[model samples]
Target: MKFLRDILDKVKPNFEKDGKLHFLHSTFDAIETFMFVPNHTTKRGAHIRDGIDLKRTMFIVIIALVPCLLFGMWNVGALHYAAQNIDSTLLENMLYGAMKVVPIIVVSYLTGLGIEFAFCQVNGHPVNEGFLVSGMLIPLIVPADIPLWMVIVATAFAVIIGKEVFGGTGMNILNPALTARVFLYIAYPVEMAGEIWVSGIKEGLVDAASGATALGVLGGKDLEAASNYSVNVMDAFMGFIPGSIGETSVLMCLIGAAILIVTGIGSWRIMLATVIGALGMGLILNAVGGNPYYDLPAYQHLLIGGFAFGAVFMATDPVSAAHTTTGKWIYGILIGVLTVLIRVFNPAYPEGIMFAILFMNVMAPLVDNYVVKANIKRRLNRVKA
Candidate 1:
């Protein structure tokens, strides 16, 4: 017993001098300290730090994205099941959707991470956790039928030009995932066009059918001339409407928005302002004898296309979006207004989220500048008074 106690003492870690712990101590430390609030000795300028490291921040983003991803997968399978004229089982449909979406997820992570690691080594900076969130985001925005090689190419372009060229990670002005979508849109118009519909695997007698999204159909025809051009607003809200893989369901997107808002990871102002702006613009367009181009109802415009996705996710990105409280409102409203405007007026592109986000990204710096100037003027007036 004495010998055993001696051996244990010899192996015990010094928790006082170096703050090192062994076994149970280390486990407790990791749980109560590192995960909750780490107490690492800071050698740099900052003395204290919170538990929210980059990894934690990246994880939070992934958590917020969970709703959309799960919904996208289940929706894909459900659509395929519906196409086949079969009875829907939620679990079975999600499993089927997982089979298709998983590959896209894998390809996106491998390619995006490959570029990210190379940049980290070359630039002598630590590997950024940003790509962990971005990789998932890229695959979600793409269509279920998008080719694998195109995904690789788009990932490369988005990482290199959209991020690395701008000095990487937090310095980037545009959302990397949006950059990938834009590249694919311009480079492969045939593949990325709104008309393409995917055929899923058949089970038993259930045969899937090919059809176009309401937005795509509307874009193809003049709404004023076509009596049946109007889309079911409820279907769009419920996410049965055809669009991008993860962008179809407005209901799911709202759930995601709620998670983001509750976690304090997303800006509620941006979300609210964008919706208000879109509805406001839609009402304005409706009042002037209606723009033939935008014959869809105001609420319908919000539910269709990538408007909800953009307003909730892309527009609220901390790095790319406006930082000031007021700037967030202005920026978000502009994104919504532009999204509707582009959808209504621009015949070349049916979906406008990508353009709206990119346009706002460029304007973010200018918006911040004006916001800062206003703050300074207010301070100066206060001093004089």
Candidate 2:
């Protein structure tokens, strides 16, 4: 560590003002900080410094995502072989999965960080580590077999349009990862979904092989039909099923959630409220009993699709989600309720968390405003009384 720090110190001068590499100072700073925490501190004024900074916070979320990433990679390999009735060892599965998953992750980081660094150079500001999390998230949210070119386009779209357009990461209204997903979804609906769930899966390879996800099966039929198709609670929860790279495993998502909550980085209120809202809405649909999907158990909603992943990671994005304590509950509940509603109502497309989170991102500020105003009013009334 000391050796690396010394090397950075030696090269730092060249990237300082009026130096030969001054033009790339932002880029250098990004690399340096990533390797080591900034030692420079305030010399004046009374400032309360926390143990962690933005980069550190982003890394914490990345740490939380590690379990999901590893599981997703193995699951991809498992599904790929299972689709063709090939029985392979765990190492073989992971090796194949790594070949597919790693490139997407590389493209995501390179594309996003390249754009961010370029913006920083042009804007003459420090490069924010915001894309660190978003880059990992993009790869995880996408299918393992998605084209590299599409990832480039979607990542560029996410960084430039979803984030940079709104004045960089902290200023963005929507989650960049979800933005990339939505872009892919809208631009290439056929590629974004369906058989992309499994890598290199051939058609009619076996009598009992299907590439469709649990949610995909549920989209067209009732709970019983979906179950009959082998979409059950245990398989989905354990992530031994076909779905997006990281979203297939509810257990992994919960593990990520635990890390986030333990580190005090993610909002537990949002997580809990989202779950409650989803169950509440699911119960209502069950009461109506108008369709097979409506008959799905409320608890099952948390176990399938991207509900757990979205609730744990996407909905709790600090920048896009509601900030106020009371507002978080509202923001999260709406996300959960809307997700179930969209899934139940729109059988053709049941992956509603993406749209629901984006919609709530727009409304988060409004929710916060109302929460703030209500708090102020209540305080004034209490004083008068």
Candidate 3:
């Protein structure tokens, strides 16, 4: 460590002001900060510091997401061969999954970081580390077969319009990963649709007949509304079903959730409230019980589609989520209710977590504002007494 520090110290001055390589100072600073803790500190009174910083927080999140990533890779491979009715070994499946998932991940990081680096250089600012997480997220939320070009365009749009326009990272109003996903989903519906989730169906090499997601089947308009949903809920729970890469397995999402909660980075209040709200809504639909989709077990909503993923990951985003304790409960419950509401009622889309989280991101501040005001009002009454 000392030897590496000495090496960095030797070249550090060259990237400082008026140095020959000063043009790449932001790049240098970014690398230096990533590799080691920044020495810069406030001399004045401020909150006491700790080892945890933004990068560390984001890194922890990346750690939490690993279970989902690894499982998503294997799931993709397993599904590809399953779709084609080909016998394959576990190693072969894992390898095939790697081949498909890795390129998407590479494209995501390269495109997002490329834009982030460019923006930092142009504006003479330190590169924000937010994309370290967003880059991974964008890949997870999209189809495994999603085009590299689409990943490039969505990543650029996510960095520029979704985040940069609102001032970078912590200032962005919406989650950047979901921004990339929603952009691709709206702009290229066919490409972003269920068929592409399985590797070869989108290319016409495999039949698309069985490629539908649980949500797609449940929400189908052409069904006998009273017919039993044919999908195995347990498979969906285990994440063996066709869907977005990282979102398939409820078990993996739970593992990620456990890590975030244990580390105290993610809000357990939000997680619990989101589940309660979703189950409550599901129960409401069950009582009204006009349709087979509504008749699905209330707990199953949390297992299917992106509900669990969004609750664990998207709703827990510290920046966009409501910061007030009361506000978080409100924000999370609304996300749950809205997600199930849209899933049951919306004709255009089957999944609702993406829209649900984004909408709450926009409304989170308002929820916090009201919570603050209510608290102030109660305090004023006590003071007057």
The lDDT values for all models are: 0.79, 0.90, 0.89
Clashes of 2: 1
Runs in model 2 lying further than 4 Å from the true structure? 1-6, 202-209, 221-230
Which regions in candidate 1 have their CA more than 4 angstroms from the true location? 1-40, 44-46, 198-210, 222-227, 291-293
Error of 1 at 244 (Å): 1.4
Query: In candidate 3, which residue ranges exceed 4 Å CA deviation?
Result: 1-7, 44-47
Which 10-residue span in candidate 3 carries the lowest summed lDDT? 222-231
lDDT of 2 by residue, 148-261 (tens): 999999999999999998999799999999999999999998777666677885344433337777677778655666656544778988999888899889999999999999
Q: Write the per-residue lDDT of candidate 1 for residues 1-385, one digit (tens) a residue.
A: 5775465446445433354553234333322332333445767685666676777777887887888899888888887778767888999889878987899999999998888767766665656577888898888888876778999999999999999999888999999999999999999997787445443422233232245766676666556543476677788888875556788888888888888888788899999999988998888777764445455678888888888988888888889999999899899899889888888778788887679889998998899899989999999999999
Estimated TM-score for each candidate: 0.85, 0.95, 0.96
Identify the candidate with maximal TM-score: 3
| Candidate 3 C-alpha lDDT tens digits along 1-385 | 8988998899999998999999989999998888888888888887688888898899999999999999998999899998888988889888988898899999999999998898889888898698999998988998888879999999999999998888888999999999999999899997776566687786787788668787887887767732656657789889998888899999999999999999999999999989989999999999999877888889988998999899999899999999999999999999999999999999688888899999999999999999999999999999999
Model 1 scores a C-alpha lDDT of 0.79
- With a 3 Å backbone cut-off (N, CA, C), the pairs that clash in candidate 3 are none
Worst 10 residues of 2 by lDDT: 201-210
Whichever of 1 and 3 has more TM-score, that candidate is: 3
